[model samples]
Target chain A: MFKLLISLALLLWVNTSFAISLIVNDSVSFSPDSSKDIRNIFTLQQTHWENGNKIQVFVFPDDNDVHQQFSKSVTQMFPYQYRRIWDRVTFSGTGLAPTIVNSMEEMLEKVSQTKNSIGYIENIDKHQSIRVIILQGDENEAQ
Target chain B: MKHNKRYFHASLLQKGLLSLLLALWIQPAFAIELADNIQVHGFLTQGAFYTSDNNYNGDSDDDVSFDQTEIGLNAFWQVNDRVDFSVQGLYRKAGKVENGDVRLDYGMMNVNLFNDENNHFGLRLGRIKNPIGLYNETRDVAFTTPSILLPQSIYLERSRSLLVASDGGQLFSKHQLGDGWLSIKLNYGNTHNDNDEIRDQMFVSYAHGDLDSEDGSFVGQIKYNYQSDKYIFALSYADVTLEYDSSSRDLIPFADGTARFSPYIFSAQYNGEKLSLTTEYYYSENEFKDFGAYSPDLSPITTNWYVQGEYRLSHKWQAIMRYDESYLDKDDRSGKNYEAMGAPGHMGFTKDSMIGVRWDIRPDVMLRAEYHNINGTSWLPNADNPDRKETKRYWDLFSLQMSYRF
Candidate 1:
């Protein structure tokens, strides 16, 4: 009985450590009108204002690891890769890089205040002004 | 005037009221959501240049001048999941000319033929950079290379004569191979000069036999890039030939006097958190059919090499140094005899070294200052004295430039 209890405790620790949760505000809808692909959510330029009236975006700083991971998942590129792509685009006058914010709190605040702004966070439960977009599970039920 | 003032005041008041209402309406009618499509961005830069010696020859002593000031605009519109249209435009001053001539540098349309996880293929038409070396491909206003002065060996001043900036079309594709990438580009087309006199001269006098015709020579380039998180290396090869009208002009023929050039280059760069180093070297050979009747056989090979290093002192400042040298065949230098009588066998050598600093005042703006010491073993027409022979000359060059991008 003691062995079984210890094994259960270890399983719980592993599960909690590797838990992958995509945090969003509580009010965001997963329906088509308010829904978007991960690519669209990460790369979009403008968002609805936090007062829920207009559009704009909240961006990750250039050196942020979360931004790097987000870009990697969406564009399949690293920070430098995106930088080179953006550099070529900007230099040629074809597109611009995104605006950056410093911290997750800043990102959350901006996204909450400006409806058009969107950013990712590790902890979604603390923010009351936004809604989380439900992400479907993978074949392995990883999410 | 009073009536106009009243009208203007009324209009201003109306604008304020409309803006307030629009803000209010926008606040609630729209969910504070970001647009999933459409983007706006640009960059700007300004800088100055100074030459220690009056390098301008007979030109004015204003050793300092605006090095670069440019603005760019970019728009990317997603038509659908698989298709998007991208366009870019730029306005900047000429780099080599004495007068600060502002011109549209690039306006191109891009269509992503294919964009996959590990590979991408695209078609670009309009003004595009001739991708020769690492810097030439990204020499836009927003991308500042570590070197204050560009590598002159491969980035020749004469490249403009051979390559097109916006003219013609190019097909390019990149394939990702694990930690490396391979890119292939094929380009064809002709650039028509606005100046009739210059165009005619380039075709009839400057070009080799039958090269100046409507069918300009074809150019092809292959580049392989390998990058890990900290280090990067690139290898590239390019060949170009221009045809001239030999039958129409008074031509002096030597053996195999066709103007043909093949350049092979290798470059490597390493970047640490606070330091970066880059090195590049190129070897090129040019062949002439008949050495202006002076020699039945004359060929010259030019070798150029440079290494540069940079260290970041703080968040906003950096220091850099570079050494560059060009070695020409000392036997085939150009002169009145070489030009008029056509001596196919006169060549000279030149070497230059430079150091500089860069201050990033902001993300879109930077200030740069550099100094160069140049030494040469031959005499150029623009030198202090053309009649002097076997001379070594020295000069000091100073320049300051500011660059910004949006």
Candidate 2:
């Protein structure tokens, strides 16, 4: 009976702990701004930071679980939809696609080390190289 | 037998060249990183098509036809934060419609007049893709297209050359308005036209004439994206003018004339977690005068629309369905007046129903299969199927394609 209760608690903890949010290089010092503003950056529609520095975007592959979760929870979009947008603009010579990393660790390493870089992670850890920017609305809004 | 040998040799050369280009494209992406902001990308697509009755591209009526292939290589050099240069080279062979020749797709310089986090204004000079509709800019890229073929009602492949790109300039602006984003693009230029194919499709018979583009033609589109970019609405308009200079051919008894085509399209799309829906409605007016043999008193206005839905079945699979309709004359949907004029009634409209599935074989490779049930042959160009009078009213088509990108 005790083992069953402990297992159930562990599953709940795992489910609730996957809190996804935006993570940017330490150079950014913005608050919960408009979701539309962030969408433009991630989509490569917007390229410059307010300070006139080119914004580099890092992301995981389309099928990555955390990537999908971040897109849905933060941007309220499907992974394929986001990918299609990138393909349209990139192949058309109208815009560029974000740099894709193979894993979340690479995403963190790239986003943290590169200047003006932005990315997302689940349960982001507190680090001097990166800062977590809370999204404007409730993360559960995507549901 | 000589013609067959030439065709075989041409296909062999195409294969060898594409294989070499593919090898170059497969080089390490990190090598492109040597140049700070230079990015190179390319795509290769090959399709096999079979039809139940009528032909679609090549001899696809009863037997499988391998007449469609698209290859492209594009590069972008961000010279500076405020300026960039882009170029793309493309080779496409779609039956007689595209003659499998390498050509420059788009080569332009983009200068950002003003750019910040919230607002952007830019000017593009030289050859640029016509920003007419959502799919026109990247129509040749199979990865960017929703299906093996785009909805032909709005993006008719018959006159693709005239609508694809222009040698002129464009001005574009994007701004964040309250909770939404607004983007506007305007282009002015002269576009290239395939004279023989254009004449064949426009006039009943091939007119021995040269098609010339009138200067000052323009295209514009305004797009509003809201709801965190999940919803998009766009309005596009274009005015295309062509003048036919008749050649001295007794068999082609045609006089010099001018043709004007203007079209307006409204598009909307909604993206959801498991489903995405898209719809577009367009109205077009085409006017031709002083053709000697064929002339219309007034412009004929046509209407077309398509409703498409896609459902993501899993991480690697998707299902799609779309219904597309077009009428040559909105007021005469039955096409009786067209039939009375000695042309087949079905020539005035087209209705197509398509169902398809897509699988992402890998991140860089994709496989697609689709079936289409079509009524009417309005969109079929005479170049592909010369016997228009014998075209059946109802037909079915099936196609499969494999596409790779890097």
Candidate 3:
């Protein structure tokens, strides 16, 4: 009984480690829209923001664990589906692919420094460089 | 002899493409990092095929052939919020038909006239890939296609150059439609006017000449994606007319004529977590008129379709099965009437069943193998097998390919 309890606690701890949060530059000045809208932006269907600023998207590579987690939990999609969508648009010359960063540190740095930039990281660290863009359902609770 | 001259001319275009490709391939190596918004990507693939009977992608009868390969490089730059530029160059060798030709696949400048939270309106001008079915735009990319060779029923490999891309302008809009997203595109341009393979295969013994695409060639497609991008449905249409300029030594001496080809396609797909199902149907009304000799006025409505299912067994392994068919005349499924029209019975239609596996060895590298059991020789490329009598009614083919993209 004691072993089962400890194993369950360890599993929860591992699950928490896989959590991801959406982040954007401080200049974005926009709240996360509906899930559909967020998906469109990431899929390159929506090229610009409401304020006429070109949306610059950054992301970790497809094989990254954090990237997969963010795609499922936040975008509500699998990595292959997301990659297929990007490949269709990119290879067809209909749209551009998002910039790929090598590491989470690079993703954080690029998203924070670039204007109108958006990305996700494994954790939401308190820093002046980045601001967490809470999702639609979590916005009120976060505030 | 006329076909030889045309091939020579086409090879010249290929040469120019090759030089430009080289420039692009080496430019980035020496150039400084332009900006964070500038991105360059490319892919390379080499394929080998073997056939029990008949020939495809080269003379693959009872022997393996490595006459299929593709190389492409593209770059994109976001100049600003409303404007972006993109260009891709391709070098492909598909047996005697394509022959290592380098071509400009697409070079377009997109201007986002209006963009908001839910609406996007854009205009693009240059050589653009025609949005026929789901796979037409990125058909050459091995990673993007379900198989190394796409379904020939709808995506005909012969006469591919004419249908792939055009030089013109396009206007597009993407907006929210109820619970799904709707995308509409309209384009008008001059077709890529390569008539060698078309004349060789489509005309056969009936006629021979150079085909020149006249004005007023256009294409359009409308697509809707359901919530979360699970289900997608699209309809596309294209109308292209080519003028036949006859040579003196033609099989049937005749005056100049016009060949008008128009095809309508319906496409749908359901994408799930580990399983994906897709299908597309095509109907084409093609007419040839005014060739004053023994050539009779011919108007044939060809129909074709394919059903494919893919299951991802693991992160690195995937399995696929598909059934594809194409009929030269829907009314004559057995081709008895077509055969009576001086064409071989096997030319009337083709049915193919295929199974394949793909293993992604790495994020950028992939290896794949597939087997095909084909009935009828309707889609046999004329360039590879110039003599029709040599083609068999039933054949089997196995293919292996490796591709890498960065």
Candidate 4:
């Protein structure tokens, strides 16, 4: 019983995390209205931007803290679900998986340099070149 | 000439896949980065199986079997905005069927005709995996599935090679529905019919001949995802035709005959944060006709289904439970007709209850183990069990697999 209680407490603690920003390349013109579009972009269902630039998806690894925050709080999905989608699409040769970066620094760098790319980070600095996409849903605000 | 040409191509594919497997050994998964906009990925899986009272994937009855192994290397190149090309080579071993053979899994050139955030259209030409169920295309890759063994009632190993992939073209389209997306795919091509397991399935013990399906086959699916990860639904359909030719020297050889299969699948799933529920139903119509003096004309309507639940213990561990069932003739649930026709009654159906656990030891590695308590022997592959009468009605199977992917 004590072990079960500890596991439950840990689950709740992990479920609660700090917010993360949905960083995108500044060249994208249209903004996503709801969390569905954001989820579609990460899952590779939405491939191209309004301006015709192909969507280059980037992400942290499944075990990353920022990734856990972005997945649970923002997209309302688990990280393993994203991994499942990516692996299924990749191995079947139907689509592409997201590029994995090491840390927030790498995430900021990749999203800033790549064209029409999208990723997330815990915090953005003042001079970073990437644009922050604010979701309109009732979830959580940007960190 | 055509037969020889096909043999030549198979050998070429074997050599290519083998050399690539050797080349990728030195450079591990994480260190090797090919180029920008061009990526290469690969995976390897090894499994050992132990079964009581029946043979599976080897002589596994009361013995440990190591016949299940798969290695694959795939490369993808995105050429500009509208087109991309991808190819994969595979080396797989599963008992005497698919015995350490190399195969060209899929090589496709995809062209995007039109695309936006809400709508997209595309075409893929070359060898491509058939979009049968949600898991058929990525079935061999252990990282993509729920357990070491997929539900046998729906994804039967006995006739797997026939439905693995096709050499032809496919058209795919996606459209935004109410807060979700609906995708449609249509494929028309020729599937391989050279597998001995399939031949064993189509004929009786002493009826030695060959099975061919040079004619074309058709497969299509319509799938809908609601809220991206909340609810999913799909419907898949396929029609295949196989022909048999008798060899002169064979004893008890029958004349040329034809067999046809038309199957429909209904699939649904619910994905929550900690738990996932999946269920699928399969209904098929089989027809066998025009074999002089073999048996009688037969048509069996088959049904199969499975329901499963998975729970995540943490990010790195998960558990699964499933109940699967299959019937060759729904009217004869006890297989009484088969028993009347000189085969075991249990040969016409199978019911399996399974439990499994998975551990993700690292980001690129996974290990899974499963145990199944099964009743009946309808889905056992013939290559592993040459005589149907030797199989026991009640059996058990345990398997463990380790996989590496990047």
lDDT of each: 0.47, 0.76, 0.78, 0.78
Compose the digit string of candidate 1's lDDT tens values, residues B159-275. 543543435666877765654567776655554322222222222223234343244434456665444224556665556553334443334442223455667777777666567
Deviation in Å, model 2, residue B255 alpha carbon: 1.8
Can you tell me the CAPRI class of model 3?
acceptable
Please provide, for model 3 over B1-406, each residue's C-alpha lDDT reduced to its tens digit, 9 standing for 90 to 100. 0121211122354355445545544442211225877777887777888888877887678776777878888888888888889999999989888878789999999999998877888899999899999899999999899998899998888768888988999999999777678999899999887777777665674556788897958999999988646899999999999888888778767678888889999999998889999999999999989867555688989999999999999878999999999998788788775466566688889999999999987667778999999999888888888777667889899999877677
Residue pairs whose backbone atoms clash in candidate 2: none
Name the docking class for model 1.
incorrect
lDDT of 2 by residue, B55-83 (tens): 77776777666788888888887776688
Decoy 2 TM-score against native:
0.87
Candidate DockQ scores, in order: 0.15, 0.36, 0.40, 0.49
Task: Give the TM-scores of the predictions, in the order they appear.
Answer: 0.63, 0.87, 0.88, 0.88
Best by DockQ: 4
Least well predicted 10-residue stretch by lDDT in candidate 3 chain B: B1-10
Order of quality (DockQ) = 4, 3, 2, 1
Q: Which ten residues in a row have the lowest lDDT in candidate 2 chain B?
A: B1-10
lDDT of 3 at B57: 84
Best by TM-score: 4
**Chain B TM-score for the candidates in order:** 0.69, 0.91, 0.90, 0.91
